[model samples]
Each structure stands twice: as structure tokens, then as C-alpha cells.
Target chain A: MYRGLLWLCFLPSLLFGQRTDSLRIDFRPLLNGVALELEEEGGASAGAREVEVLRFYLSELQLLEGEEVVFAEEDHHHLIDAAQVASLQLPLTLPPGLRYDGLRFTLGVDSLTAASGVFGGDLDPTNGMYWTWRSGYINFKLEGTSPDCPARKQRFQFHVGGFQAPFNSERRVTLAIKPARSISIIIDLDSFFAATDLSQQYQVMSPGELSMKVADRLTRMFRVE
Target chain B: MRQGVILLVVVMMSGLAFTLSSPPGIAYPDHFPTTAYDFRAHPLDSAKVQLGRRLFYDEILSADGTISCASCHSPYNAFAHTDHDLSHGINDQIGTRNAPALFNLAWSTSFHHDGAHHSIELQPLAPISHPAEMGSSIGDIVRRLSEHAQYRQAFSESFGDSLVTGERVLKALAQFQLTLVSAGAKYDRVQAGKDTFSVQEQKGYQLFQTYCNDCHFEPLFTTGGFARNGLRVDTTLNDFGRMMITALPEDSLLFKIPSLRNLSYTHPYMHDGRFRKLRQVLKHYASRDVRPMPISANEQSDIVAFLLTLDDRDFVFNRNHGFPH
Candidate 1:
């Protein structure tokens, strides 16, 4: 009778479906080693710059085991906003008892989805990720204020996106990993800011040579901690 | 038995809701080509169309709540402005190009004179965010719509919730535009065998088929392709139409061909609205640098007569397309 009672309990759980676990990717915005919170001044290591906004799209997240495929999010496009704490933490639902040794995700939205028209949720134009005059998603947006920047308000804006060929900026970021409660990923902004000459190369609002290079450099800043 | 009965009621109620909320079938003439807009992606609903119409006429879309889509593309003008040659927008600022007419838009593959926008869903954002146009961002507009009680209710009715999202707003706008089909003209009646064109119109039709048919294709009256029509570049504007978007030298001076439908109501034609009369347009075409037409004065008059047949008064005067009362 006890066994049958336990089976009844198990039956309801089975009805719910799937003995699954989720992998949480914790994205930490760091100026070198220190976390830069909001519009707060980056520490001495970060060249006294202040990051106002940092948002980018992480799409088609997948878990890989060597050459074998483990899990794939075929149509997933996640907008990771540094301002929104929850938006940075990406949780991936996994199949039961699945084991993976590697992680792979596209750093930006694909050209097909960019051309497909308006979409709701994270991909929605309301998210402020889409370009208005030109039809395309701004895949990686980083706006900040630096004393060295030669803009009107000392503001530096890098809205990196170009889905069309010859300047396609979407890049795949694959990181070798080990299974754990959460995957720690750090976006080192210090290196990103250091590489640019803020005086001349601060503004990148449209798709072209500058935005494409910024997008390429952006894909390299994602490091597994 | 109880479960089955509940399911049946749910199904029936859904059917009832669909029948009540969705408008009647869109009646396209048999001669019209397949729609460029994939309707299967976002099916037309009456509630959405109504919601879109309200938004279109509402000045709240602008930053200062002074301008609306109808401000430039009025219903009485066949959705194209007449008071100005160039588009007028927020803060009494003038725009670069003419506001194109808004009818039979479902067949359009691209938006803007430059074809910068690929889809209708993303087209409104151009004017809404342009500094000289509505001068409002999509983010600001979403917030404004969310705060309004009537808009909230309308959104709920249209989309099954009070979520004033960019996608919903854009989709609703697209739905309303797609419903603005103008196949009720005398040209359509002639094509449908219900009416016969006058002798003058018939001769104009032959001329139109011979010379003008390549660019302004039949039925929809637009090939929906960009062409370099050899109009001298406006020195003040210095606009490089298709080349501005593509950045290719070959695409320089190429502009999206405007539809020939509703030429009477939508006067002051051309991409720049340089010609107030059809005679000037014909004259310019004949004297144009590229592929100049050899049309004469009498031929221009006959062509104008045939062009007048393309005007559909029913479409321009449709009460459904006007501002929401």
C-alpha cells in the first residue's frame, strides 16, 4: 500500500513531464576584475569611464559534448541587458541526465530574423534594440561617458549591428565548460575601452566598417570565469 | 461526458469570438497578383484594424502630440498629402521626400522611396523616429499607449491583452495598411468585364501597355522595383535615393516606382512631388535623359484620361479608413 501510495505521488510528477535541470549562465560586467554597477565610475583600472548602458543579443544557445550534439535552442534570441539583473542571467532547460562539456551561443541575432519583421518579447522593437531609420537589430549596444570622448556630451555610443553580407557582424562564441550549478561568464569591458581611441573613435551609430570591427571585438570579450 | 461537453462549449465560444472579431474576407480582384505580404504570418482581424486606425489618426504618436500618420497621409487625399510638396512633420519641420500614398500596400515588398525598410511592420518606425517627422521613439510611444485607458482596452480587445508592445503596434499598423486595398476603380471594372473604357481611354491604355507597362505593371500599377528614371537631382536636397541605402554606385539615383492608382486624388506626383499636374509629369518623362518617352501632347491627354480611370473614389471616401469617431 505504501509502494502504491508512492507510485501515485510519482504519477502526478510524471504527468508534469520531464526530469529536467537548467543551466544558468551568470553574466558579470567587469571593468578588469571589479564589477561596474550601472552609471558608477569604473575603478582606476577601467580608465575612469562610466558605462551607462550595455545590452546585446545572445542567440541560439547550445550545449555540446565534443563532436556530438547535446542540446540546442534553435530559435532562441535573448537580449542581455546589463541594467536588468535578471536579463543577464540566462537559464537553459536541459534534458534529464544530460551531460555536456562545451557551451556555444551566437553573439548576435541572425540576418534572417533581422529581416523577418517585428517580433514580440525580447526581440521586440520596444526593447530599444532595433534601429528605427534602417531596418535591423542593434545586436550589441554600449553607451557610456568618458572624459576623453570628443562627443557633444562626452558620451560614447557603440550601437554595433549589420546583418547584410560583406559586413555581417554576427559571430558564434563557443566556450569549453564543465557541468556545474551555474556557468560564470565575465564580460571584461576594460580591454574593450582600452583598444579604442575615445577621442576619435567613440561614436558608432550605424552599420559600416567601424560597427563591424566593434562587433568583432565584442564577441571576443566573452570569457568563461 | 462532462469534459467533452466543456470542450465543445470552449470550441464553440472560440468560433463565436473569431466570427465576431474578424472582419469579412478581403476581396481582391481575380486579376490582381499574389500579395507580397505573407498574410499567414499575421492574419487580419477587425479589432486590430480598428485599433490601428485609432493609432494612425491619434496625434499621441508624435513626441509633442502634434503630428500623426494621417497628418501627412490623410484619408480624403487617398492617404497622401496635398498642401505641401515635401512631407511636413513635427514642430512644422519639412521632410526630405514626399509622403507616399497608402493604398494597396500589401503588394509592396519594401518601404520608403529608398527601399531602406524591407517590411511594412518596420516602416512606421522611420517616420516615428525621424527628427523632422513624428520625432518620437518607439520606446516613448509604447509608454504613452500603455498609460492610456482607452488604448489599453483597445489593445486588450485586439491582442487578447493590454500589452502595448512594439510588435503589436507595428503588426496592427500593418494589418490596417493591408486592409486598404483599392481595386474598386473603373480600370478594375473594365478588367472584370463589367464596364468598357471610352475610345480615348482605350488608346491611352494601348500606349500605357507599350511604353509605361514595364515600370508601372498592370493591376497593382507598380513593378515594385527601383529604377533610375533620369530626373535631375534636386540641388538643395542632394538626395541619392537607392544608393543612400545600398551605398553602391550602380544604384545611384534609383528610386522605388510609385503606383499609378489614384492619380487624381493623389495629385502633385513624383518622388519629390515636383509636378503638380499630370501634363508636367508626362512632359518630364518625354524630355527625361534616360529612356525618354516620345509621347506627344494629344497622347498625354489620352493617357491622363486613362489614368483618371485608375482613381477609385470609393477607396478614398471609405468611412472605415478614416479617423475613429
Candidate 2:
């Protein structure tokens, strides 16, 4: 009689506890498996070229459980290089029991931080993120000599950053992670280059419309794989 | 020898008495504009002023703890920096612009050459964080100050709480500078009819009224507006005066029109400290077919003489306000 009662309580507890489990997320920028191809309007193929990654800083990161911002950070000063950007995992703590329905984050620094006075540490000019003469960040820098670029021998540089009324360039995205599993978010480089033509808007040096245009398109290319 | 000694003794006695009884505040005359700085925010307390005086002289604000505000704005030369064009900061790093005079700051609407700082309270942040200036963060300065028992007690006394922040540091500096008002001078006496300008000074006053008064207006001697002032841009710096803030193309060469009251003490005029002498400033104005009206050489001399009347000796040599013992 006692054994029957214990089994009755244990059966429902095992069934409900494992059903709504936590999801671990690992964000990755696909470096090797991805092939980037930039084609102009005329269907002219732009060949592959070696490029050095400028920097990747968290402009904004937010974990949304429904409408509320469960966790958010503005002007986070974490600096990541090309090698690190290839595979990045940021551990975030969430509220217990409530699974995150969607996740959203940005790709570059905001316009206000760029315009506000001198900053030290990761934001400093010594870090090579700041533009010395011109005022703004060189966000999403891709440098390599290309056949399509005007300057052939010298590295073809695309430094995009802009945030203002007309030139806002911070990118935002939402993705779904599976239940009770680690979600790996992959940034496909092929889709980023395909979205916008680098030949037309080649070098972006400040917080303006062009930076926002590229960042908005590039941020959407990120997906949960 | 005995008669000469008696005369010298009497002179020394009179000097000692005169120094003891001297008034501390500026004596304003009629016809000047009212003071703009709201002294009510931080009421003038002799004790608080003394505390602020000590902080100004203290080098604890810098990261390396090497420089202070007094290291730049010296008290002897009417609170204007001497012997340097650009103000130097920690690690001997040179700044881009010249440090302006500190007296009569009560009348100033804004601070810095660009007017980047709106309130006088916010002015120290410019120097505190500037890479070429103090080269230290405010948070770092607070942490350093909090470690010292003297600063910890003083912060509690001044702010009521023991916490030290950048806002408190800036406020203390502003409190000290706000007390530097200059109203007593030959010009004030002449305005009061207690004294009159010399014949040359009168001619200079006339010339000043005609040309300089449009911008460098009477009383405070500054319209307190940013102007082109006809300065050619320095090639290396390429600083766009007010345009750095507004991002407007028209405000490219414009800078704040500084007060001309202490022309005798505060040498090296203009934003870049380009001119060493008052005659050079007069010459620059006289040679002005550039932006404002064309001022003549004869008129320039008159303006210089008139500027001399604005100097207040009492405000400059006030022993109470000088470096604390």
C-alpha cells in the first residue's frame, strides 16, 4: 500500500520536470565552411581575397522573454578578433523555468558613444577601433585586395560605422533556440556580402547612414543552426 | 642715518595695517551688467572655499597623481596660465587649446573654447578625461581619493555622504572658481565718478565703444558669444572651434569671445595663445578687414588704453584667495 502511493507521486513529477528544460546558446561566425561572393548588378563575379578582421564589439545584447528585456547590456566593451569571432560563446544567465522564446543582439557601437568625449580601454584610439582624424568607429572592417575594388594592390578596406538620424547602422536580430539543448548561432559570411555591394559603398569611416544600411542587412544574416 | 630709519619704520607700520584691513570681495560700480553665476547653488563659505582651494592645489585628481588644476591656472597671474600656449597635463602631454582666464567666470554662460561644456559644473570632465590633459578616468580618481582618510572625511563634510564621484570633484573646483569675481578697477571708479580716465584713456574708450563694443561689450567686456574673430586655422590641429559640437559648417572658425578685463595680467590672447602682447591683439583687430569692421592703428591704441582701465588690482592681489599655507 505504501509503495503504490510513492509511485503515484513520482510518475507525474518525472513527466513535468524534464519537459521544460533550459537551452544553452553558443554564437559562432562561420570562418572556414563559408564562401563569400559579392556580385554587382550585372552578375559580375567578385573573386575571393584574403582579409584581416578589424574588430567585433557588442553594440547591444538583449535576451527577450516575450516583451520584457530579461537581460540587456549597452556599450559592452568586449573586444574579439577574427579567430575569436569565428567561434564566440557568451554565457548568459536567464530567469529560471521561463524559457527564452527569442534572442536579439546588435553588431557595432551606437552613435551616441561614438560622438561623446574621449574613452579609454577597449574604446580608446590606441586599440585601433577609433578613427584618429575622422570622428567615429571603424566598425565591421574587412580589408583585402579585390579585382572589383578601385584600389587593387592596396588592401580593399570596408570600415562601416554610422548612427544618427539619417545614418543609423546598428543591426538587430531575433532567433529561436531549441528546448533543453545548446543553440549555436552561425553568422554566414556568404549571405552578408551577398546582401550589399561593397564596390559602391566601399569604405565607411563614421556613424552615418551607410554604416546602418550594411549593419542592418548583415545582422539579419545570423541564424540558429 | 637715524632720520632715514625712522621714516622706514613708519612706512612698514602703515603697510601692515593696510594689509590687515583690506576687503575680500569685488566692489562693483554702476553701469555694469549683473553677475550671471548663481552663487545661491553653492553659497560662498570661507571654510568651503578653503577646502576647495586645497583641492585645486592637490595633485590627487590625476591618475599618476602628478598634476592639479592649479598646475595650469595659477593664482598669481589672475588665475590665467603663464609661459605656455597650450595647457599641459599628466605625463607632460600637451592640450590642443589655450586655457582661458578664470576671473569674471561668474559672467560666463559656458566653458571651454568650443562651448562643449554647458554648465561650469561639467567643465572638469573635459580635462579629466582628455587624453592630452589629465589622462585619467573620474572613477579612477574617486577610487584614489577614497583611499585617503583626509579626503574621505572631507567628502562627508562637504557632500553629507562619504561617497566620492566625478560630480563632487567638478563641483568643488567650480565653487572655488566662482568666487573669483573682478569688479574693482579704475574703470569702475570712473563709472562711479569717484575717478576719471586720463585723456588718452578717454580716447581709447571712444575707440572701444565704436568697434570692440559690438562683441566685447562693456562691463563684463564680452558679449559671451562665439565669433569667427578672423583667426586663420592652425594646420596641424585643424580644430573646428564650435563646429565640433554643432557640426555646422558656418561655425567653422568661430570661438568664444573672451573677457578683456584682466588684459594686463592675462597675456597671450586668443584661443591658440597666438598673440603675446596686448599691442599684437590691437594690431590683429586694427588689421581686421577679415571679418568685422576695419579698425585703425590710432583707434587700436585707444582701445588698448581703454582695456587698461578694466584691470582690477584688488581682485588680482587678494591674499585671502591665494595659495593656502
| Candidate number with greatest lDDT | 1
Clash pairs (backbone) in predicted model 1: none
lDDT of 2 by residue, A1-225 (tens): 999999988988777656544555565655436533322232233465444553565657776778777667566755545545333556554445655567776666766666554455556444556443334555666555544555545345667664444555555677764344567777676576666465675665555455667667666657878
Residue pairs in steric clash, candidate 2?
A161-A206, A162-A207, A162-A208, A163-A207, A167-A208, A167-A209, A169-A212, B204-B302
List per-model TM-scores for chain B: 0.93, 0.86
- Tens digit per residue, CA lDDT, model 1, B114-185: 998988898899999999999999899999999999999999999999989899999888788888989999
lDDT to native, each model: 0.87, 0.68
Worst 10 residues of 1 chain B by lDDT: B18-27
lDDT of 1 by residue, A91-192 (tens): 888877799999998888988898797898889898888888877889999888888987876888999887876667788898999988798998989879
Candidate 1 Cα misplacement greater than 4 A, ranges: A1-10, A14-18, A40-47, B1-25
- For the record, the alpha-carbon RMSD of candidate 1 to the native fold, in angstroms, is 3.8
Error of 2 at B2 (Å): 61
lDDT of 1 at A211: 81
- Top candidate on DockQ is 1
Model 2 earns a TM-score of 0.59
